[model samples]
Target: MGRKLQRIVEAAIIERIGPVTAQDLMAMSDDSWGLIRDQITDRRNGKDGLVARCLACECEVYIRTSKTRGIARPLFQHYNGSDPDCPWFQGRNIKPDAARAAQYQGKQESNFHRLMCELVGELAALDSRYIKHTVGQYRSPTENEHGRYPDTYVEWDDFGPFVVEFQMSGTFQTEISARCKHYEREGIPLLWILFGLDTATALPQSFIDVIRRHRGNAFVLDQAAVAASREQKTLVLSCYLRKPDGRLDAPKLVRFDALTVPRSKIPYHEDRIVGSRLAEIEKVRRPWFNALAQWEDRYKPLRDLARPQSLLLAAAFSIVAATNGKGRNYASEHSNISAMLNTYLSTKVLSPYSDLLKQIIENTRSSSIIKASVHDHLRRYRDAIQATNESPEWILLRKLLPEALDPVLREELAYLDALPDWANPTSE
Candidate 1:
């Protein structure tokens, strides 16, 4: 008799978010789970991916879909070849290559997959801007070490190169990630078009992964899209946008240029991930900003919220306001930011937050605030402040002003070239 399939993994410890059980995985919103899933896939592809380890043996784990009574749910599973010694080990996973071989029985690409590539290439050539297009051509990157052979490669006169990979079968996460990163670094936009999406009883995990990478967009090249592409003189796709309710919205024919091409080059119609997160962060800080903006004299409006834990926020915002040319002092009755900071430091009110304040000033465009006079003032209060990097204020500031205070978030935004002008540190 065949050995019993390994029991399902129960839980995983995500790097930044802590513990996530199978139930938690299923309960999370689509975007949330998608972010975690994409990070796991990225990690598997050898990028600086999210670290999620099995709760049982501390082995790295990835999220996989499990169907119960026709309803699909996500569950944690150890990667292939995980330690059999672990209680949660599901035995060795069938290698992706071995599974593909068994499914195709020897063929690499399905006949339909090839036909879809040819059709996409033909449709891509409908646009007047199209220069050339190839099917399954080897492409060497201008910068990266390895090269890739995209399913369909299209070039435009002014728009440059674009890649279209047709997803027809189960694809390994590593394969998905490598292609995504390779094209992104090569300055080429990549689009993954799904086949048999309309006929699938339940969408496969591979299809779901591609949709998530596209920020909940699922593209297809149906007859409608083909006709639309020809009429519009541009590559058009039938785009099904995944709603927050975990269901696909009505499919719409969207032009290729209509899609938002982020720095990662994964084209999506809606920014379901980053845009939502930044909006949530902004929502939390909106009230404080409003209150600070209307500051008249130091009264209950400011004092009521100014506990020791929150005083740093007030002072920091005051400095930020000054830098933005507002000249508002929400923290103190002083006329200017330098005077307000000097008063707080001399009185030992903001002394404990000296390190955090210095970091904020140095990293903002307001570095000029640290003049010779201010340096002398800081030296006088140095003994009292006992400035150290381990300030608790950093915790508060990192969340409020992440662009300037949080190194990780700053680096991420910088990479995307999306960092706001006000948050730029190098500006004089």
Candidate 2:
């Protein structure tokens, strides 16, 4: 909002993270909306935090923090369109009235990071080779004139060593330079998660350029979309994308590979759906919901826990909505907790807490906890599906709308069709 902040966010984009061009960096962040939204539906009942991994270097780091705390770090969040270089990334400049929306986003992201941290922890706890962390900050330096703090220092493993500071967005020129100096002078392997949240706002490539300007071990984390650093690497794309025709042509596949070119590119873009898929989604909701409803009845009766009771009720409604009053499951049915979790895990968005889930199942005292968790997660799927009236699974389902009598029925009809017909709901 202020000139000082503008400059800092801009400078940090390029200084701390490299490979992103100045145009990209400048196009990144935008004006703040109102307060961010904080109400998160944490189906996982998991902790919140940030996860960073380097496949090239075979290193990983995880840190947890509250939503508000998470938002304060000045990374590239949704775009209010401070930079007009890109219009595709930004839906519209909604920040003027987005305080509430932003607040919700911040909170949701907090939950997201929390679960991610949990997954990372579970991963590291599983394998000693991985460096999982519960990053706790003892002291945070005062904000500079632009309200940016120096590279964050967290309380890590040893009493006084190996804590990480994530230069989230707008690369930190000073921080990177200082990091290089620190490396030369103190040899600290500063683990930086050069990340961005591209919604309406995408970070400018300039941010990474700034980071590169700094001479240090500050290897740039792969930006989303631009591919996974040649090959055999890890990347954090906002939401995975496929071809417009849903026909992964060879060149498109090659282009997709190119998107992951060197470690220096982040071409994160919104997913573009192709043809009659949306119509097909509406077509399938009925049967899919029917199966889901049947399963909920079967599963809820067996749940036998207070936590699960609430979840069961919510899921029942969702299934009812999808069944649309039913008949089939689809291949893309993701309206279940396990399904959604599978989606994220399969896509490499979040590491799976599969082991943790198994652990919860085994924990003698936490059976109710596990049951409730499973139920709650499934309920979230139902609720999201119902609220949007998108389709059977509401998530993957999509189609063109037909003329309808009223908004309510229209919504339900649309949603019913969204259910995938071949998910084989009986499997899990």
lDDT of each: 0.74, 0.30
Candidate 2: where is the Cα deviation over 4 Å?
Answer: 1-98, 101-132, 139-164, 175-185, 197-206, 210-428
TM-score, cand. 2 vs. native? 0.23
Writing each residue's lDDT as its tens digit, candidate 1 over 148-259 gives 8999999988888899998766678789878888888888999998865743256788888888788779998765676687788788888998876656787889999889
Best by lDDT: 1
TM-score of each: 0.62, 0.23
Q: Which pairs, if any, clash in model 1? A: none
TM-score of 1: 0.62
Predict model 1's lDDT versus the native.
0.74
lDDT of 2 by residue, 267-377 (tens): 222213212444454565455444444554433432233333323323333322333323122212454434533443344322222332232223222232223445444
| All candidates: CA RMSD (Å) | 15.1, 25.7
> By summed lDDT, which 10 consecutive residues of candidate 1 come out lowest?
100-109
